[model samples]
Target: MPRVIVVEDSPTQAQHLGFILEEAGFEVVLAPDAETGFRRLNEEHFDVILSDLHLPGDSGFDLCRRLKADPVHRNIPIVVCTSEVDPVNVLRGLQAGADGFVTKQRPPAEILGCVRRVLQRGCAPEPSPSARTRVTFLDQDFELTAGREQLLDILVSAFEDVVHINAQYRQSAVALREANRKLEQRNLELQRSVESERRAHEERKRAESHLIQNEKMTSLGQLAAGVAHEINNPLAFVINNITLLRRDLGYLEAMLSLYREAIAPLAVGRPELVEPIEEYAEKVDLPYTLENLGRLLERTAEGAKRIRHIVASLRDFARLDEQELKEADLNTGIASTLDLARGRASELQVALETVLGPLPMVTCYPARINQVVLSLVTNALDACKPGGRVIIGTCVKEDGVEIAVTDTGTGIPPDVLGKIFDPFFTTKSQGKGTGLGLSISYGIVRSHGGTIAVESTSPGGTRIVVDLPIRPSPTAAP
Candidate 1:
C-alpha cells in the first residue's frame, strides 16, 4: 500500500484527512505542522505528502520548496490541500514544486484522484539535456575561413539550445492545461450522470412497487369476498337460534307464572301443604331466573346482531363488489375497521376507543379507505403493551376529514420512524408481519390526494394522522 503523510495543524482536520486516506487503503502518518512534517520525512520515505495550505508557521508553499530543494526528498510528490481557491495561488504552489493542488472543500474522491495522478506522473521527470544533437550549417566552410568563426559558432549553438528548450516547455504547459480542462468537464459530467441514474432508479422502484400493490389488492379483493360469506353463513344460524331460544324462554316464563298463581291458592288454602312447594322453588331459584332471564336473552340477541354487522363490515371494507370511486361517510369506514379489529384487540388486552366527529361525506374509494384504517388500527394495536390502549378517531378538518390512530406503546424512534412507511420495512418479529401494511396504506392515502404524518415521543406513544381532500383528486389512479 502507498504511504501518505497528512500535514495539518488542526487536530480535527488532520484526523479527518487521515481517516479518509486510511479507509482508502493507504497508510497515513500525521504531522501537526511543517516542522514535524519535515521531521517525519527524515525518519522514513513516503510515496506522497498532503499538506494543508495554512499553518502556524512555514506554510505549505515553504514546505514544498524545502522538500524540492533537498536531493533525497525531491522526488516525493506533494499535493497541497488548500482553502486557497484562486488560480494564482495554485500556480504559486506549482511554481514551488508541488505536484498537485486540491481544494479542501473537494470531496475525498477528488483528492485521492489528484494524489494518484501525481504518483503516475512521477515528480515531473527533471528536464535533462539531450545526450546527442546534430547541428549542421550550410555556411560552415565560410564561417571556418572567417577569423571570428569560433565565436559565431558558439553564439548560434547557444541560441538553438535556448529556442529548443523554450518550445518544449510551451508544449508541456499546453498539454497540462488541456488535461485540466478535460478533467473538470469529466467531473461535471460524472456528477450529472450519477444524479440522473439515481432518479431513474427511484422511478423504476416506484413502478415495481405499484405493480406489487396492485397484485396485493387483487388478492385481497378475492379473499375478502369469500371470508365475508363464510363468516356470515355461520352467523345467520347463530342469530336464528338465539331468536328461538329467546322465544322459548318467554313461553317457559308464562307457564311458570300460571303455575305460581295456582300454587299460591293451594298454599293459602292449606298452610301445611306450602312447605314442599317453597322448598322446590328455593332449589330452582325461580325468582332469580324470572328477574334476569329477559335481560340475558336480549343481550345475547344484541351480541349476535353485532357479529352479523361485523361480517357485513368485512365485505364492505374489502369492497369485493365495488370498483369505482363513491361518496362515503368516513365515520362508517372507521366503525367498520374498529369492528374488524375488535377481536384481535381483545386478545391482546388492548383497549380501543374512538371520538368520531361529524363530518361531510367525502368522495373516495370507500373499501380502500377501510383497508387503510384497518391497517393503521392494527399497527397501533401491535405497538401496544398488554394493558395499553389504542385510540381511533376522526374529526372535521378545514375541508376534509382527519383520521388518527394513536397507540399507548412507546413511541417510535426517529431513525425507525422515517422507514416505517418504506416498503418491506418492519420492526416486528419474523413471520408475525409482512412489513407492507403501512407502506400500502401510505400509497392508498396518497392516491386519494391525501397525506399521512406521524407525531411521536418515547413513552408518550405515537399518533399517525391522515389528511384527505374533500373530494377525490382527478389524477388518482386505481
Candidate 2:
C-alpha cells in the first residue's frame, strides 16, 4: 500500500487528513509539525507528504524547501495544504519547491484526489535494464530460499567454523546486506545528498569564479574607458582635419572652375593669360590632388564613425548599476548585450541572428539580466569558429517568457553536460574563462522564479534556454 505522511500542527486537522488517507486505502503517518514529519521521512519511506502551510517551528514552505534540497526527499511530491491562497502565497509555495498546493478549506474529496495524484506521480519506478544491480553477499552468494527457519539453521551451522573466520564472514555479509538495503531505499534521499554536495561545491566554485571575473572585468573596463578617451582625442583632430581638407578642396575646385571659365574667354581675348593659368594648374596637380583629398576625407569620416560606435558600446558595457526589479523588454536587453559583444564576435568572426517574438514585460533587474545575456552570447561566440553562427530568440509562454541562445560550434561532451552550469566548470583554456557566468545566471533566473537549462549535440553546438514566470499584480484575480 502507498504510504502518506500528513504534517499539521492541529491534532484534529492531522487526524482528519490521516483518516481521509486511510479510508482511501493508504498507510498514513501523522506528524504535528515539520520536525517530526522530517524525522519520520528520514526513518522510513513515504510515497507522498501532505503538509500544512503553518507548523509550530518551521512553516510548510520551509519544510518543502528543505525536502526539495535533499535529493532523497526531493522527488516525493509535496502537496501543500494551506489556508493562504493568495497569488503571492501560491507563488511563494511554488518557489519554495512545493509540487502542488491545495487549500485547507478544500473538500476531503479534493484533498484525497490531490494525495492520490501526488502519490501516483511520486512513486519510484522498478529497476530498468540500465539500473545498477546492487550485490550483497547474503542475498547473492548464499541460498536462503528454503525458509527463514532453514536459513537460521544454516547460519548457526556456518558459525561453527573457525571463530575468526565465522565472525569475519558474518560481519562482511551483514555489512553488504545493510549497504544494499540502504541503496534500495527511497531514491529521493540519495538524490538529496548528492545534489546537496554538488550544489555546495558549485557554490564555492562560483564564488571564486565571480571574484576572478569581476576583477578581470573591472580592469578591462578601465582599460577600455582609457583607450576610448585616448582615441577620442586623436579622432577629434582627425575629423577636424578632414573638415578643413574638405573646405580646402572645395575652394580649389571653385578656383579651378573659375580658371576654366576665364580661360575659355581668354583663349580668344587674352591668350597669354590662359597660358599662365594652365601653368599654375599643372604645378598644383589640381585634378588629381582634389580627387585624392576627397577620398581621404570620406575614409577618415568612416573611421571616426566606427571609433565612436566602439566607444559608445564600451561605455554601456562598463556602466554598472544597482540591481532593481522592474518591467523590462527582453528584446531591448538582447540588443544591448549584442552590442556589448561586438568585439568578441569580431575576434571569432561569428555571425549573430535574432528572431524575437512578442514577449510580455517581465519584472527583473536590467543590468544583471543584461550581464547574463552578454555572458551567454560571449560564451557562444567563444565556442564557435570562423563562419559559425549564434542565434538568439525570445518568445512568450503561457506561464512566462523564454529566451534561447544557440550556437553552431563544437558541442559539449555528453559527460560534461551536467557540470556546465557548475561554477568554475570550463572547457576553455586557462585565462580564457572564470566559469561563474552560467552559474550566477542560473541563480539570478531562479531568484526571479525562473529556470535555465541547456541542450547540446555531440558534434553540433549548444543551446541555452531561460524561462521567467509572469508575475501578475496583487489586484489581479487568480
lDDT of each: 0.80, 0.74
Please give the lDDT score for candidate 1. Answer: 0.80
Q: Could you estimate the TM-score for every candidate?
A: 0.58, 0.51
Candidate 1 wrongly placed segments (more than 4 Å): 1-177, 180-197, 261-284, 289-295, 457-460
Q: Give the alpha carbon lDDT tens digit for every residue of 193-223 in model 1.
A: 9999988875775676677877877887777
lDDT of 2 by residue, 353-416 (tens): 8999988788776555676788889888988999999999999898998889999998888899
Model 2: CA > 4 A from native: 1-200, 213-248, 263-289, 321-323, 358-361, 457-459, 469-478
RMSD of each: 19.3, 29.7
Of candidate 2, the 10-residue stretch with the lowest lDDT total is 142-151
Clash list (residue pairs), candidate 2: 70-192, 71-188, 71-191, 71-192, 72-188, 72-189, 72-192, 73-188
TM-score of 1: 0.58
